[model samples]
Target: MTVLHALAATLSRAGRLARAAASGPDWWRGAALYAAVLALNFVGVWVSIRLIAWNKAFFDALGALDGQTALRQVGVFFLLVSASAGSWLAADWLRKRLLILWRGQLTAQALDLWLGGWAYWQLRPGFGAVPVENPDQRVAEDCRKFVEGLLEFTLDLISGAVALVSFVALLWSLSTFALPACFAGQVTLGGLMQLASAFSQVTTALSWFIFFNRDPAGFVAVCERLDGLMAAARAPAPLPGAPQAILRTASPDGALHLQGLRLATPDGRWLPALPDCTIRPGARVWNSGASGEGKTTLLAAIGGIWLSGEGRIAVPEARFLTLPAGAPVFAEGLAAAACYPEDPATQGSAKLNAVLTRLGLGHRLDTADEAALSGLSMGERQRLGLARAALLRPDWLVMDEATSALDPAFEADLMTWLSAELP
Candidate 1:
């Protein structure tokens, strides 16, 4: 069963690679560069063979004590040497070009799929999708190594195949050189040597890469990780526990509906269940309870973002945004962080300054540089989050104690501000 699954996965991966190659930019793709590099490499091998023949002639001239012939052979030696060196240099250049093109093409596609449809968010540890550790390494370094090693192996294979086919004929033509007549003439020992040489090259190359190097393992690990990321992203939301747990994507505005709503823990157990209820549009509502109560869970359920357990939530398809108790600030500068989810320039600097001042971040009115936001305390960050929400004015804002980090008076002031601003 595992073998069969492995075969299926290999085929799927190959198909995906083929499609990516086809879809990539026509002029700048890796395959075309690789093909050109392969041709240049074959030329290099052919030049190398010529240089070997040049060696024989140059030595024969010296053995015969022919200064003229030896001098001529010296010039022939230099010519072949230059040609071989040029071929090697060109092939090396093209091989590197192929690496970058392939890495860029693959990494861009992987990032697109990984970030598609909010998969990055959903694939967190406690979220529905399976978490992928070291995703940054997987995307950046893994993509680079995968492309580099694949191109290296592929070029070597092509070179070995070309050498086997062409050099065997060259060997057959030179059968008079060293091999016994019975072997080279009757059994074709020279051709056999060529085949052995090609086979040995392949064996040595693959053995070194797989056994003595880390690239093969890295390639396999990256492949499996990227495959899992795609699989998790493509997975559908879990089915509702029963017909009672209906999911509404588009309901009328301000009409929050909940029927037998049950929120499940990450492990699939129903932890907090809410009875049927409706909070109509424009309703002034406050939900309070101890830590174990379903207050936060209820908000998640009502927002139609919670996926587990039994019940229906008919929340409107309005511009819904949630502000968690611990608000997140980015390192994208004060203005950018404050105006997140909307471009900072959309609202003018004056309005942003007013909101920041109201949220007690008035000192940051002139702070637009990208110094790390890590210096901001939790409460200060929450203040920025509130400022962001206030500036954007979302239609259905769900606050999960978004003001919890603030002092009591400031918390009350922020809540009142939310009520006046959001309503």
Candidate 2:
């Protein structure tokens, strides 16, 4: 029951996971390998059937004490055993390989759904209708479990069905049935038919219990989480009565405009409303307040990623960049992280190398850190975020306490660099 519970939960996500993977051509290529694996597994099952016959012959020779026959049977037994073993081993290897590929595809699908179209952003507090907890597990661990579980159950079912069919045929061929004369007189059905019907009723009831009432609590838990994430990913462009013009393309002249726009919490409660403020192009304006003053919320609303806000905001598109409080770093190496939100390849190696050097990431340039960029301190993450802004050369840059982590001197140096470097 424990195993069934675990399997049902994981397999619940398999259909959606496979659909996500099948969206691309690479996963389809994996399907061909899947067919090959099935063929190999069936061939192994056939070998087992042959081995069962060899078992009878070998035992008969031994029972007769026939030395010549026993020796020949020994040779035959070895051949059958070797064939079955080889077939099983080969099929096992193929199944494992298939598992790896299938799991990889499923994982990639989950990532794309979570990351693409700002889905990750909306799942944050005050942005989504559904609360998604431990999305990390859903995207990583659950996907692994789902792929492995589905393959295990699917293959076992296939092999068991094949073996059952073979055994039933053998039994039918070798068996003879008889009944008491009185019983035969009372029932028109033959003894074999009566036996078959009785066995069928028992097996059918057992199978029904196994199939329809199988525990699915584990799968249900995952399904609810994934469904929430899916809802977040499919979240509509704007909430009810959201002014379309306000969410339109940013002002062309690099001006930031706010007209009666009020920032709200996730549940549509007003946090702090902007009293119609405007920042002229190239003007230096500062927004400051005590803690919980909705500073970050304001920044998000202006950036257009926050749908919890109401009213109007006009900001730039590509020329606008936001340096949020926390640096968003990916696992792709240092160069990629520095040029994030923009392809690293577009910035030549020499240019990226120079930016890292100028931003005091020269040591990182050598390390070429290809991991998650997790080892970096708060200050280091801030530096990388700033470096990205400089590289992008955005006409409009919004910093929400982006420089708070760095020392005053370093912060001054960064502001000075940006002033000198950006137009």
Candidate 3:
């Protein structure tokens, strides 16, 4: 039962992604590309059928010892081969291009949701009530694989259907021919053909039933990954007044206010409750506590991320940015990473370089290669996180142990720079 449910869910998600790609804004172009591929596939099938006929003619000529006819049939063989190869290659090229195009659309949508709100954070294994595993794989690898599989399977199905119809018709026509008297004592050739066809179809059906009942490993893995991606895309959005224990409202004044605030884990275990208080605009308050003391949870509550809480938290209506303990660094260039969540092109390179320089990440700006970026130390990553905050210059900045990796002196220096630079 669970397996069936998972399969159903996988199909539902796959169908939605496929439909979205097909009906997206560039639907006409996608439709055209698909039609071209399908037409090419049909042409290839026709060439194959023609080659089958050519084989009969060539063999007949060879049996007759007709040199001229045999040579002519060989020439026809080359023509059919050329047509088949050309159509197959063309169709293959178009199919690949279509695969990439659809993958792009699917990846873009997945990314939009993954990065839109607290989804990236909340979908972590232990972060939310319902966690999605290997979200990165879902966005990067699974999207590509899913689209590739969909196309490959669809084309294979079409080819099989066309071949089945053509071959069945040919067989039916040939069944009219009488066999030798010794072979056909009573049963007609048509009856024999019908029986063979029926047996073949029943065997094929049974084989497929057994194949599905056993649950192929590769397909099950794909379905599981698709299910994860679907969950990631549906992760809760970071918005005020979400359906959670907390009731968030917009502050009329430019201040952060908490009233009757209480916190709890997703499992319903209560945490230290925050006393009713207000942090007015321009207040540089810091939350400090030992590890596992709910300081980070408090920050999450203030940021509208931790939903398992009851409170009337009022936040100012402004651009908000949160810097977690380990800020994310993208494979995109240093400049882009520094000004993340915002287009790097919109920000001047000089400003980006200066921010990184201020944060002591200037030396690392030369390389945007992912491998090089991966080697960044914890301190350097925190500095980059600060650089993002600096570049974005949000009206409200929430740091949850964001500078924990840096030495005291450097952290203090960065803090001073932030205070001087931001309001």
- Full-model lDDT for every candidate: 0.68, 0.68, 0.74
Cα lDDT tens digits, model 1, 1-423, are 998997678658645653553367653456577778888878877765665466556666666687998899788878877887887898898888777776677778778867765556555665553566767777787677666656666677677667656655555565554457555464343344444454444454445444644455566665676666556666634333322244655456558877776677645666655668777766767788788766886776665545566766777767877888877777677888888878999989899888888887888655556554647888988888898788888877778888788889878878887789876
Q: List the residue pairs that clash in candidate 3.
A: none
Model 1 per-residue lDDT at 345: 96
For candidate 3, which ten residues in a row score worst on lDDT? 206-215
Candidate number achieving the greatest lDDT relative to the actual structure: 3
TM-score of each: 0.77, 0.72, 0.75
Winning candidate number (TM-score): 1
Candidate 1, pairs of clashing residues: 245-311, 254-281
Candidate 3 regions off by >4 Å? 1-14, 20-23, 55-69, 129-131, 175-217, 232-243, 325-337, 342-390, 402-417
Give the clash count for each candidate: 2, 3, 0
Model 2: weakest 10-residue lDDT segment is 186-195
Q: What is the lDDT of candidate 2?
A: 0.68
Better of 2 and 3 by lDDT: 3
- Please give, for residues 1-423, the per-residue lDDT of candidate 3 as tens digits: 998997787678668778755666777877888889989988976775665456557766766688999899889989999998999999999999898888888788778778876677766655565567778887788787777777876775676577556655654554454244326585433345444553454344344434533224665476567656666557653333323668989998889899998887655667777789999877888777667768888888888777877879998998988898887888876777788778987888888788888888788777655654777888888888888888888888888889989889878988999988887
- Taking every candidate in turn, the Cα RMSD to the unseen true structure, in Å, is 5.2, 7.2, 5.9
